[model samples]
Target: RKDIAVIPYEPRYQSAFKALNEEWITAHWEMEEPDHKALDHPQEYILDKGGHIFIALYRDEPVGVCALCKKDDPEHEYELAKLAVSPGVQGKGIGVLLCRTVISKAKELGCKKIFLESNTLLRPAIRLYRKLGFKEIPKSHPAYERVDIQMELVID
Candidate 1:
């Protein structure tokens, strides 16, 4: 775990972000427009909109990624999304590191809550979210067709 480094978005690793996310998404669920918009141009959809993306590097190679997407709401919430880890490095604590980094970043942004939309098909991911203190919440109007469950973590 000490060898893994979680860093902010960099132009050089843009492809790695898309590739890492697409790996899991395409394998389990079909890619939606929201995925394309975020993965194709992270700067336009995330960074410029006051959101943040974190990438996990293992031995100087990209292995995981997570994004905290700002919501245009009065509550000042962010959607913790696009969490993915390389197939080869699955269950190696990379996802937890990326998520913790995003949670910290959300707090730094003064966010009131962090929510996420996911599908029931990914049981492991759901468990991870729960372990991170995310509780199941009523599903909102999801942006992607794949979302079946919603969870939220109130930032204190």
Candidate 2:
């Protein structure tokens, strides 16, 4: 097993962050826009909103990332977003490790539930969510317009 460490996002990870977004769009979203610019926009907003971004490093190399957005509602919930793993390092269980870490962090934050939006094109990721105990939920968010699936997990 690789030595995996989760750290908050820092300026140093800009390149790795861009790479992950580019790979995800090229492989799954089929978007032609520059992922770095598109991703950086939201990254800025999330950081400003008390959101937590975690980067997973394996052997000192950035391999994956996940984020938890603090909820605005009084429900004491959160939203998990921007989950990405280096294409070269995928299937090595890094994604799962990142996800488990995010979930644990959310629970520690006293979140009652967590939600996420994902595209149906990503079959493996959808499966991973199910395996992690996330269940399908109604697509009510305006952001769901670009997403094909929405899921939620109740944190105990």
Please list the Cα RMSD from the true structure of every candidate, rounded to 1 decimal place. 1.0, 2.7
Over all chains combined, what TM-score does candidate 1 have?
0.96
lDDT scores of the candidates, listed in order: 0.90, 0.78
Query: Candidate 1's residue-wise lDDT over 1-156, tens digit each?
Result: 887999998989899999998999999888888899999999999999989999999999999999999888665379899999998989889998989999999888888789898988999899999999999988778888888999999989
Clashing pairs in 1: none
Report residue 18 deviation for candidate 1 (angstroms). Answer: 0.5
Give TM-scores for every candidate, taking all chains together and pairing residue i with residue i. 0.96, 0.85
Q: Against the true structure, whose lDDT is highest? A: 1
Task: At residue 5, give the lDDT of candidate 2.
Answer: 83
lDDT of 2 at 23: 76
Identify the runs in model 1 with alpha carbons over 4 angstroms from their true place.
none
Candidate 2 deviates by what RMSD?
A: 2.7
For model 2, how does the per-residue alpha-carbon lDDT over 1-156 read when each residue is reduced to its tens digit? 448788888878867776786678666555433334336654566667777778889899998988787768664468887789987778888888888888998888888789888887899999999999999987765353458788999987
**lDDT at position 106, candidate 2:** 89
